[model samples]
Target: MSRYTRYGGGDPLAPPVDLAEALDAIGQEVMAGYSPERAMQEFLRRGGRDQAGLDDLARRVAEKRRELLARNNLDGTLQEVRELLDTAVLEERKQLARDVTMDDGDRAFREMQLEGLPPSTAAAVSELASYDWTSQEARAAYEQIKDLLGREVLDQRFAGMKQALENATDEDRAAVNEMLRDLNELLEKHRLGDDTEQEFRDFMDKHGDFFPEDPQTIEELMDALAARSAAAQRMMNSMSAEQRAELMQLSQQAFGSPELMQQLSRMDDNLRALRPGEDWSGSEEFGGDEGLGLGDGTGALQDLADLDALAEQLSQSYGGARMDDVDLDRLARQLGDDAAVDARTLAELERALRESGYLKRGSDGELRLSPRAMRELGKALLRDVATRLTSRQGQRDVRQSGAAGERSGATRQWAFGDTEPWDVPRTIGNAVRRTAGEGGVSGRVRIHVDDIEVQETEARTQAAVALLVDTSFSMAMDGRWVPMKRTALALHSLIRSRFRGDDLQLISFGRAARTMEIEELTALDARWDKGTNLHHALLLANRHFRKHPNAQPVLLVVTDGEPTSHLEPHGEVYFEYPPHPLTIAYAVRELDNAGRLGAQVTFFRLGEDPGLARFVDSMAKRVDGRVVAPELDDLGAAVVGSYLGSRAPSGQADYRDWFGGRGFWAG
Candidate 1:
C-alpha cells in the first residue's frame, strides 16, 4: 500500500443540543393564545438555526458555475503552452545571435519554424513537443505545460486535486492509482453483495486518507460518491455541445495516463448502477463572478440540490404531513446539528400531544383538542387566575365551600343527622389521649358515642351558571375570538373542577343560540356570520335558570356587539343592524325574566364599541347585574373572578364585595 498524506484542517464537531426545549417553547406559545401553525413558524424563526446558510451555499455554487462558463474559451494549460513557446523561441534567437559561430542555414531554419506555425491548437501543441530546444528554460517550460495539462484534467474529476498535485511526482501518481483500484474493487463487491463490513473496514484502513468524509458504512460511502458523480454528469449536461467535446478531449490528458481515465470511467458506471436515484441529468445556470473549475462548481451544485431538499422537508406544511415526517439527517447535512435537534424536538412534541391525548382527530379528519386538552387548558387558565389573585392579595388559599364534603380544621362531637366526614387522624389522637388518662386494661380499646369526634364543615350554596359567548363574525375579525373561547373554557373548567355542585351550560350566539358541551365549545372554530343574537342567548339563560329553580342562577354574558338579532316564534331568526327596537325589546324581556328569577347577571363587554358599552350598561342596570370591560389579556381572570365572587355567602352585597372592591371585579 502507498502512504498518503491528507491536507487541510476541518471544523471541530460540537455536542448535539437537546430539542425538547424548542418543543416546550412552541407549546407555551400555543397555550398563550397563538395557533399551532403560527407558533411553530415563530419558534423556527427565532430559534437560531435556519436555512440561510444553505441558501448561501446554493448562491456560491451558482456563482462558481458561471465563472467556469465565462472563462471556457481559453484553456489554462494551452495558454501556458503559448507563453512558454514564445519565451523559448526568443531565447534560441538570442543565443544564436550572441555565438557568431552559428551557420546561416541553421538560423534560417529556426526563423522559418518560428514565423510559420500551425494555427490549430492541437497541431501547434504536437509540433511544439517535437521541436528541438537549446535553452534549458524552454525545455523546463514545455515540461511544466504537460504537467499542468495532466493535473487540470484530473482536477475535473476530483475536487482539491489541483492543490494536491501542484508539483507532480511519480509516487503521488502511483498512490492515486492504488486508491482508485481499491475503491473500484470495494464498490464492485458491494454491488454483488459479496462484501462484508470488515472488508469495508479493511479497505478504509489502508486507503482512508483519500475520503475525508469518513463514511461509516458502505451505503454512506456509495451515497457520497454517487452525488459527486451525478454532479459531474450534470456539469457536462449544462455545457454546450462544442464545450462538451473539448472537455472530454482534455480529460484524456489527466495524470498523463490512459489507465487513470479507464479506472474513473469504471467507477462512474458502477456508481450509476448501484445508485440510480441520483439526479444525473439535473443542471443549473451559473451567473456569478467567482472563478471555479468544473469539479468545484459541480460540488457547489450538489450542495444547492441538497439544500433545496432540506427546505422542502423542514417546511412541515405538506398535506397529511406531521413533524415526524421531517428528515433529520438530511436537515443536519444542509443546515447543522442544531437544526436536526430542533426538528427532532418538534416531532417529539407532536407525538407527545397526540399520544398523551391532548390532541385527537375529529370525525372530519382534522386535528382538534381532545376532552383531556380542554381540562388541561382549563387548569392552565385556573392557575393563571390563582397567580393573579395571589399577586393582589399577598397569597391566600382559594378554597371552594362544600357542605359536608371533606374534613375541616375544626371538629365537633358526633351529633344526630350529622353527615360530615370524620378527621380520622385527629379523632384517633383524641381517643388515644382520653384512654391514656383513664388507664384502661389492655385487650382492646372501646369507643363510646360520647368519645367520637366529627369534622365541622360549612354548607356551600350551589349555583347554576349559564355562559353566553358571542361567536359572531365580528369577534373573529377583531381578534377577540380566541380570548372569548379561552374565557368560556376557563369558566367551565373552574365550575366543573372546583365547584362540583354548580351546573354550567355553554351557549354560543351568532345568528342563533344553542347549547354546547365543554369539548364541543373548546374545539369550535371561529364563525363567519354577521349577527350577534344576545336576545336568543338571554332566553336560553332564563330557561336554564327555570330548569334548576333551586340552584342560584348566575348568567355570564360575553359579547363584543349589541343585540343585532333575536329569535321569533316558530324558531325563525330575525337579524338587523343599527339597533332594531324589536330586538332590544326582546333582549330586555329575556333579561327581565332572568332577573325576575333572581339570577345574578354579569356582562363581560369586549372591544371598544361605544354603542355596545351604552347598551350593556343599560341592560346591567335593568337586571341589577355588573358590566366589566376588561383588557383582552385580562378577560379570563376577570370572568373567573366574577364566578368565584358569585359563589360567596348570600349576605355579601355583590360580587365586588367578595373581593374587597379591588382587582378586575371592581371595574
Candidate 2:
C-alpha cells in the first residue's frame, strides 16, 4: 500500500536547504560592515541558487494586480437592464400592431405610451410598472428585470446568490428574506456583545446553505460578511456617478417590492458597525471593454484586496517583519501553489538559521555572529582559498592534523589541551578491562573518561603569529576591506583548527592600533582616518612576540600605504601625510625591534603604487623577510601560504621549500 503527502508543505525527497550558503553570504556582508540582522535579511532578499527571492515575488504580485485592473469594467448589470427594457418595449410594440380587434383609440393610446417612455432604463422601468402590458412575453420580460436586479444586489454581498436565485419562486424569496432578518439580528447582538455560541449555531442551522464558507463562530461570520460588503461598496465606488445613481434607483425596484432593499440596507449597516477595520471606502480604476456584473465586480475588488495584502507581505519591510507573516493559503489562491511553496521554503530557511544557534544576540541586545557561525564561515573561506592555492601552484603536501610531530612508541592518558593522536586500540582495551574489573555486564564495551589514551609524540615548536591589517579609509575606498577581513578569518580558522598549539593575535591600525578578537575584527567598520600607523601596529606585534618569547614569532602586515602616523611616547597618535620623516623613522625603528626578536616578517602589498612597492621592498630587505604582491581574490590564499611557510620548524629553508620557487614572493 502507498500513502500520499501534501506536495509543497515540504517534500521529503527534496534536498535540504543549504544553511552554509546563507551563513557564508551573510558573513561576507557582515565583514563589509553590515549588522548581522541586516546581513541575514539581505541574504533572504537575494535568495539562493534554486529559489525565488522576496523582490521577485513582489514584482509578480504587482503584475497580477495590474492584469486584474486591465481585464474588467463595472457596467455589466446596467447593460443587462437596458437590454431587457429594450426587448420588452419592442415586444409590446409588436403586440399593439397585431391587435386589430381592439378599438383604434385604445390601440393608439397604448402605442403613444410605449413610444413616450422615459429614456433612462431605471426611469422607464419605474414608469412602466403600472402600465398593463398587452403581450405575455413583454410582461414576463419586465418582471424578470426586477428578479435579476434583486439577485444581482444580493450576489454582490453573498457570493453565488445570483445563480442560486435564478427562476426562484415566491416561497424561495420569502425564505431568503427570513434568513436576512435572522442574520441582521445576530450581527446586532454580536455588536452589542450579547450573542452566544448556541445562538450563532442556531442561525447557521437555519441558513447554512446560503453561506458556503461554513463560518464556525459569530466573529468569523461577521468577518466574511463585512469583507464581501466592503468589496461590494468598493465596486460601487469604482463606477461612474451616473452608473451609481442608476444602480441606487433601480435597487429599490428589486423583487417588485422595496422590502428586500430595506433588509439588505440594514444588514450592510450592521456589518459596517461590527467589522470597522474593513476598507469600505477604497476604490480602484479598471480600464477594459469587458463588463463585470455586480457579483463578478465584487469578486474582482476582493482579488485586488488580496493582491495588495500580498504585496505588503512580500515587501518584508515593515517593522519586526518575519517570513512567517506571509499568508501561504492566500498566496496560493492568487499566484498558485508554486508561489506558496517558494515562500514557505524561505520561511523555513530563516527559521532554521535562527534556531541553529549560529546567530546570537550580544549583551547590547544586537544580533551578532556567534563563534560557531564564525567557524563555519571561516571554514568555507579556507576551502575557497585552498582551491585557489591548488589551482595556481598545483597540489602540495599541506595536510593538516592535530598531531604535529612523529609519534613515539609510547601512550599516555589523555588530558585537557592535548593535541596528540588518539590511541583507539589501547583506549578500547583499557575500557574493556576497567569495565570487566568493575563487574559490569554489557554486550558492548563502554569507554570511561579515565580509560582514554593518546599516542605520545616528540615536542613540536609552536608559533606566535601577529596579523596587522590596514583599516584606513583607503582600504575601504579601494574595495579591499572585505577581502582583508576574509583573509584574516581564513588564517584564523586554519590556525585554530589545524595548528592548535599556535598563538594568534589580530591587530588593526588606521590612526592608532589595538588588539582585537577575531569576531570584533571581522565586524569592524572602516574608519575614514588619515593615517597608516604601521609603527603602532608593529609595536603591538612586537609586544605579542615578547609575551610568547619561547615560540617562533611571525608577523604578516597587509597595507597599501607608507607610514603616515606614529604613536608618541605620551601614547597620543601624531599624524602627517606625504611620508612624514619622523613617522617613517618610527616605523623603521619598530621593524628593527621586530627583527631583533627574530620575527619573520612578510609584507603583503595590496596595490601597484611605485612608491609603496619601493618602500615595502626596502623594508622586506631590511628584515631579510619576503614581500608578496597578489590580487584581492588571492589575498586569503597568500596570507595562509605565508603563515604555513613561516611556522615551519626548519626555519627560512622550509619556508622557501613550501613555496617551491613559485615566484609568489615579490623580492
Candidate 3:
C-alpha cells in the first residue's frame, strides 16, 4: 500500500447539497433578462454551490481529450518502429554486398542471412533480434524500436505512462514487467473463479504505486482496466488493415520480449470474457491530422460517448421531464460531487414547483406561471404586507373584517327579509329527507318554503374596490414595474380571500385604461407606452363604483408618475409631457366625479419625484383623498394597509388615523 493509504482513514462522503436555492437564484436572474443557459454557467462559475451540473464539465473534458488526440501523433511510434526495422534490414544487405574480407563461405553465409528474412513483422523482429549485426547503426535502430514499443503500449493502458517511462532505468523496467505479470495472474485467477477480496487486496498492496486512482474493490479495478483494454481494441479496429498489422507486429517488441506481449493478449481476452458489456468492438473515425495515434484517440472517443449520454440525461428541456430523472452518480463522475448535488437540488425544486402547480410550460414551449402560482405569489406578497403592517402597528394583528360581516356558521330557515346567501346543499338535503319521510310521493322531491335554509351572516356594509396600476414604460425603466404588480396582487388577494363580499376590479393604464381579470392582471408584462393616464383610470374606478352603487367605493391608485395623457372624444389618446393642462383638467374632472360617488381614494406614489409629489398632494386635497409617498419596498404593505383601513368601521376616517401615525399620507 502507498504511504498515504497506510496513514489515512477513508474520509466520509459529503452530505447532499440542496439545489433549490441555486435554481431560485438562477431563475430570478433569468427573469431579470439573462438567458437560462448563461445564468446557469455564471452560477457555476461563481462557485454557487448546488447539485447536478457535472454533465457540462464532462462534456468539456471529452472535448479536451478529443483535442489532445487530434493534436498529438499517437501512430508515429509504430511508423518509427517499421522505419527502424527497414533501415536495419537495408544496412545488413549493404554490409553483405560491401564485405571485402569475405571468402566464398563468408559470402554464402551472408547471402543466406539476407535471404532468410521472415515474411511476418513479428518473425522478422525475432529473427533480427538473434542476428549478430555487422552495422552498428542497424543494431542501434532495432534496439530503439524495442524501447519505443514498450513505452507506447504502456501509454495506451495508462495516461502519462510514456512520459513517466522516459529515460527509465532497468529497475523501472523490471517493476513494469512484474506489475504486468501480477496483473495477468490476477485476471487468470478471477476468470477461474478463484480470486477473493483478500487476493485482490494483496495484489494492490504489492503494486499500488502504479494505480493512483486507488479503487476500493476488485470490481472497480476490473471496470477501469476493462474500459482501457476495450478502448485499445477499438483503436486497432479503427485503423486500416495495413496500419493495424504494422501496430500489432510493433507491439510484440514491447519490453524486447514476446512474453510481455503474450501476457497482455491473455489479459485482454480474460477481461473481455469477464466484462462482455464493454464496447470492445466499437471504432471511431478520426478526421484530423494523419499523425493521430491509437492511444488517446480511442479513450477520447469513449469519453465523448459517455458525455453524449450524460448530456441527454441532464437536459431538462424535454417534454414533461423533470430533473429527478438525471443519474446522479454519472453526473458526479463527469463533473464532480458538487455538480451532482446541484443537479439533484434543481431537479427537486422543479418537481416541487411542478407538483405544487406553481410553474408549467405553455403551448409555446416557454415557462409561465400557472393559476396556482399566481395565487401563491399573491399570498406570499400579502404575507409580506401583513408582516410589514404588524411591525409598524406594534405587532398587533390586523383585524380582518368584511363589509357584509362574518358568517355565523349555522343554518336557519329562510325569511322574507333575509339578505344572507342560501345554504343550497343543506336546503336540498332537508327537502330530500322530507320527501322520503312523506312516502309514496315519487314524482319529484319538492322544496317547500319552510325547508329553505339561509346561512346567517352579521350585518355589514359591502365595498367595491378598484385597483389602478400604471404600466407605462417609465414604471419599468425606473425599476418599479414588478413592485407595482406585486402590490396590486397583494391587495387583490387580501380582498378576495378576507373580504369575499367585496367586489374587486383591476385597472391598468398606459396611454389608455382598461379593466382586466385577476389572472390577466397578474400575468401582464410592463408596457413600453409613454402614458400614465390616471384620468382614464379614475373614470374606470367611478364606473365600477356605479355598477355596485350600494357598496363602499375604494379606489387604490399605484403609480410612479403624474398623468401625462388622457382619452379624447374619439377614443384616441392625447399624450403630452410636462403636465399637459388639458390632461390635468381631465384628471381633476374624473377625481371630482369619483368624489361625488363617495369613492375612498388612496394614491400610493412609488418614487420621490418632486413634480409627482406636488401633483398627487394637490389631487388628494382636491378630492378629499389620501396621498401616500411610500418607498418601493413598502408599496405592497402600503396598498394592503390602505385597503384594510378602508374596510374598518370608520372607513376613510380610520384610514386617515392609521396613516397619520406613520406619517405616510397627507389628507
Instruction: List the candidate 2 regions with Cα displacement exceeding 4 Å.
Output: 1-21, 24-34, 390-459, 524-530, 566-576, 651-667
Residues 329-427 of candidate 3 have per-residue lDDT tens digits of 766666567656566655655555455554566676655556665565565566567668766743333222122456735455676766668889999
TM-score of every model versus the real structure: 0.69, 0.85, 0.56
What's the CA error at residue 80 for candidate 2, in Å?
Answer: 1.7
lDDT of 3 at 220: 90
- Model 1 error, position 660 (Å): 17
Candidate 2 lands at a TM-score of 0.85
Each prediction's total of clashing residue pairs, residues at least 3 apart in sequence or on different chains, is 0, 0, 14
- Each model's lDDT comes to 0.70, 0.86, 0.72
Q: For residue 198, what is the lDDT in candidate 2? A: 96
The alpha-carbon deviation from the true structure for residue 601 of candidate 2, after best TM-score superposition, in angstroms, is 1.4
lDDT of 1 by residue, 1-667 (tens): 9887632122236334344454455445654556544554556535535323223333433454455455443233444545765677677667666766778898778778766776644445456666786667766765665666566555555656767788969998898888889989999998889999999999889977767778999898898888888887887776657556655665565555778888889999999999999988887665544544555656666766766665555554567666666666666665566656556655655566557665567777665556666676676666666556445543243222234443324455666665667667767777776777799766556676667766644445778899999989898899887777778877887667556678998999999999998667655667798998998998888889899989999999999999899999878999989879999999999999999999988999998889999999999999889999999888888888777767755423232222222222322
Best by TM-score: 2
Largest lDDT belongs to which candidate?
A: 2
TM-score, candidate 1, is 0.69
As a whole number from 0 to 100, the lDDT of residue 400 in candidate 2 is 26
